[model samples]
Target: MSIIKKLASQTAIYGLSSIFGRFLNYLLVPLYTYHFSAAEYGVVSEFYAYAGFFAVLLVFGFETGYFRFRDKNDPQRDSAYSTALWFVLGANLVFLLLIRLVRTPLSEALHYAHHPEYVEWFAIILGLDAIASIPFARLRAENKAFRFAGIKILEILVTVGLSLFFIAYCPPLYAKNEQVWFAPIYDPGIGLGYVFIANLAASGVKFVLLTPQLKGLIWGFDRVLFRKMVGYSLPMVVIGFAGIVNEMLDRALLKYLLPHDPLMNMRMLGIYSACYKLSILMSLFIQAFRYAAEPFFFAYADKSDARRVYADVMKYFVIFCMAIFLLVTLYIDFFQYFIGREFRAGLGVTPILLLANLFLGIYVNLSIWYKLTDRTLMGAFVSLGGALITIGLNLWWIPHYGYVGSAWATLACYAAMAVVSYLLGRRYYPVAYDLKRIAFYIAFGLGLYFAREPLLTYGYRSWQAGTLLMGSYLLSAALFEFRGLFHFRKKLPAGDSGKSLGPGRK
Candidate 1:
């Protein structure tokens, strides 16, 4: 298959798990919004934000390490796998013990001293997830997309079921019948505790699903290969830490910078998070694209025309991502209802956050140059720049603008990284990306987005306005690129079968 077709297939499978899984998980937004106060949900959001950081720490970038080493025709593939597994397992064990020892102090530090179990159980969840990362990466390396999708979907299902049972059904059942099982553990007052427990259950299920990947493997650790993988992966640890901090530090810092009232501050955070879910429509596409693109890029890195392919991929990526951005933003009037009515007030941040994700996707594509060239330290530097931008912006703006500041921080940080990566990639490994064409698409999308309000004033409902905006963009693209769309099955000339038309070529 061609790269585009292969990407489409993999993206469909991965998107099934991600889009549907997130949709199912999104049900929790409304569930929590209705059941718990905004502040309570904020606690859940803030805690998970911190969990994101710890997750990167515990895994220590071995997932990417697996991808990097698995590509080599080493005699010690099994040994490499086993070594990476044991390394993460050892780190997770030590981290768990340390968390246990410092549980009190950590709880006190986070202002969750009254609910230290949140810290404890969260540590367990992150530890299990970290250990599970090895087998998960192996699945990707081995091309087990179906199994990957199944396991992911199953995990989401289990999490949703448990969450509903605890938060929605259990309380009333306990009130009506004290003999009900699991009632004591289902404390309604501990709003965020249920979220943690659900995550723990889901992570456990993931471990079980990965049992097949773990079996029949040599558990013996190879110190030499271990050292090599660690050398390759350690930089990634810094990159991953910085990358996650860029994404999450705003939420974590919000609690500290905001007022002392945990409940009130968390409520504000919850609103931000709930609306943020709406932005995931764009993010999910970017994630699925990355899942397929990374492996494909690395596999094709040696092709003579790989640079052209990379450039084409970036153009198409921006086109589709911008389309998604427009779709979500134009029709947010409908999607915002996914969260509760009370939380809809934060919908103002959706466009800003969506643009941030778009920039983030672009940066990911740009960073591939560094990854392929083995100059991953450059990636660390880029992400560190982004992290600094995120922190600096949050500190300056969150105090004045609240969650809106978080939105701006995300946008500014990602835009800076995207610009920097493009500049640096040109210096290190240039690809002729269609910056002019991509900018036209973005400008067109933004113009359509802003014109929606005027269109709606003419008796068009929001959904109708959205449909027209999306349809216009599609029609314009089709008109301008009709040959590219229609010539998919066109045969090459009789004497030139090996040569084919390039992107945007007639």
Candidate 2:
């Protein structure tokens, strides 16, 4: 129980920082949507969709590989770290060179021929970020939650501050012939390019701050360790690329398959992308949980009650995700204002995408089975299957249903992945997950959401009805789980302080 408490604390630190940082970044959604047309913003969205693939590709899953190999106090720990770090650094260097060589033709192929610089900037951004992942992973391994959160927040601040300076401040000043000193740096022609520049600068700042973690590089790479880590992590790369396909392929494919003119397709993509931001809370929580939970799981793997802890974690994760789903869907009237008017047309997809993200979070939790059991190849198979589902559905649906089709496709992909992962997990590394309670929470949340419209017939305002439904759900959850939570806590063995399995303990 103490271990669970520590995990919660780490998760809280990571989760709160992520929520705040991403919320700050989330503010930029309104800025972009308001300032740029849907067509213009779609270019930014498309580039980022491609970035997701390379982000996975360049790192080659070495972050998790390092965690797997660098166990506490192992003689080869430093070797594992250095080998993984050097390998990633070398790979990214080659990746950047390739991007440079192909930037022109690649930009032309992507329909951004006039601004091949976009390709160049993103290559550097992704390379820097991939290099930094190992250090971030090391932080998780070490349980340095505060430092990790601080650095993450700092990066977000840099990105958000620079974005505001370039997009919001500079253009108005340049137009009025004011701030002449800043004039030389500001380029109105850059337009949406400013967003990418802000992100690139942020990645650079994060990379610089992580230089201390690069000290491991001096240990030199080990051929044996490098080969082993690569063997383990290659499947992770496949899993990651497939995961990207599941998450981003819709945005990537929308423009090509929309059955509309190029510009209109971009317009629809922009609207869909903007509304997708409404799922930020779900995505951000999952990300923060992943940061904390991955290390926690590895560290706690030998514990007698680890499976129980994992099951509890899954239930609570579902509860919280359902809460986020309802929070966004029920109060959508307020959340809709977060994007500009043009993007509001795609708001109907918000609940679908949010639920999809919820399922993705579940899959992320369930995936620990394969990671722990060294069955990553099986994980790859599941993710690849989901990716294929996403591709086929988007190809068939986008032509008929437009962006809404993409939304449903995402939900279908994630839900299918979660189910498949869960079934496979039971076979290889069973955790008696509380499926009934999990299902109840999900069904209850959805029931409340659907009940909202019917309840409005009673003359209650949307806000009032939403508040009442949310309150009811909270009360039911508390009533059902309070006793179980307390019982678990009471059963903790005497003298168990529940501190983290620190550096050498694991």
Candidate 3:
């Protein structure tokens, strides 16, 4: 329990950036949806969907690899860090050069020949982010959560500031035909492209700020260590690629899979993407938890009680996720306003996507078994299976149901992945996850959500009904789970005269 508290504290600090800073960036969803047409926003969404795959590929999973190899007191930790850092930098540099060579052909193939700069801009963004990932991983390994959070927040601040200046402020000023001081840089022709430019600028700023951590390269690379790390981390690339396929393949495919014309397909994709942002609350918490829990899991794995600790963490994670699930679904009327009126038609997918992300978070917790046991290949196999499911379902259903089918496909993929991971962990690295309670909470939260429509006829307003449901779940959770918090310590056996039982035990 104490260990869980430490993990929670670290997550909270990281959340200062992940939740708050990203919330600032998350606000841009509305800005784009309101200011741009659905088809225009779809252009931004599709490019990012493509960037997601490259983001995973260029890193080569070295972020996790670095954490796996570096420990607090290891004499060779510097060699491990230096090896990973230099390798990632080299890989990203090669990637950028390749992008430079092929940008024209790639842009033509993607129907962006007139805007080849989009390809170059996104390529640079990906390379910069991949290079910066190693330093960020080092901060986690070293328990420098404050520094980590500060840098992350700084990056997002730059993103938000530039986005507002280009997308919101500059447009009106340029439209007025005013000779503004910033006129030299503002290009009205960029239009929706401003979003990508803002992101590229943010990545550049982050890379510059991370220069101090780049000093690890002075330790010099180790050829032998690099091979071992790559051997271990390469399978993680498969896992990550599969994970991206599960998450983003829908957006990438939607523009092709829809039965409608290309323009309408893009408009539908834009609406789907806009509603998808409604799940940001759940995604934000899971991300912050991952940042804290990944290193914490590796460091604590040697302890005898680590499995018990992981079990406790899993239970608490599910509870909080269920709370998020109910919060979003019950008050969805309020969240719907976050996007433009044009995008509100797809709001039905919000709950489906939120539940899907909840399952993904559970899989993240279950994934510790493979990482700690060095069975990453098995993890890769599980993720591949999910990816197959994602691909097959999207191909089959997208033509018929459109974006709604994509949402359901996502839910199905994550749910199957989580269940499979839990089953595999039981065989290879078992933890006594409280399945009964976890299932109960999920069912309970869904019940509250579905009951809202019928209960609205009974005289309560939507908000009033939502408040009652939210209060009921929270109160029930406190009483059912935290009853142990109030337990009095029992006396030790008479024969145990000189020994203490444990913390919180008498």
Q: Which tens-of-lDDT digit does each residue in 195-274 have in candidate 2?
A: 99999999999999999988989889899888889889999999999999988999999989999999999999999999
Clash count, candidate 2: 0
For residues 11-125, could you state the per-residue lDDT of candidate 3 as single tens digits? 9999767988988998899999999999999999999999899999999988899888875686344888999999999988999999999999999999999999999999999
Worst 10 residues of 2 by lDDT: 497-506
Model 2 ranges off by over 4 Å = 74-77, 486-506
- Candidate 1, residue 421: how far the Cα is off, in Å: 0.6
**Which residue pairs show backbone clashes in model 3?**
none
Clash numbers, per candidate = 2, 0, 0
Name the regions of candidate 3 deviating beyond 4 angstroms: 74-77, 486-506
Whole-model lDDT values for every prediction: 0.83, 0.90, 0.90
Please identify which of the two predictions, 1 or 2, would achieve the higher TM-score against the true structure.
Answer: 2
* lDDT comparison, 1 vs 3, better candidate: 3
Please give the RMSD of candidate 3 to the true structure: 3.7
| Residue pairs with backbone atoms closer than 3 Å in model 1 (clashes) | 38-267, 39-267
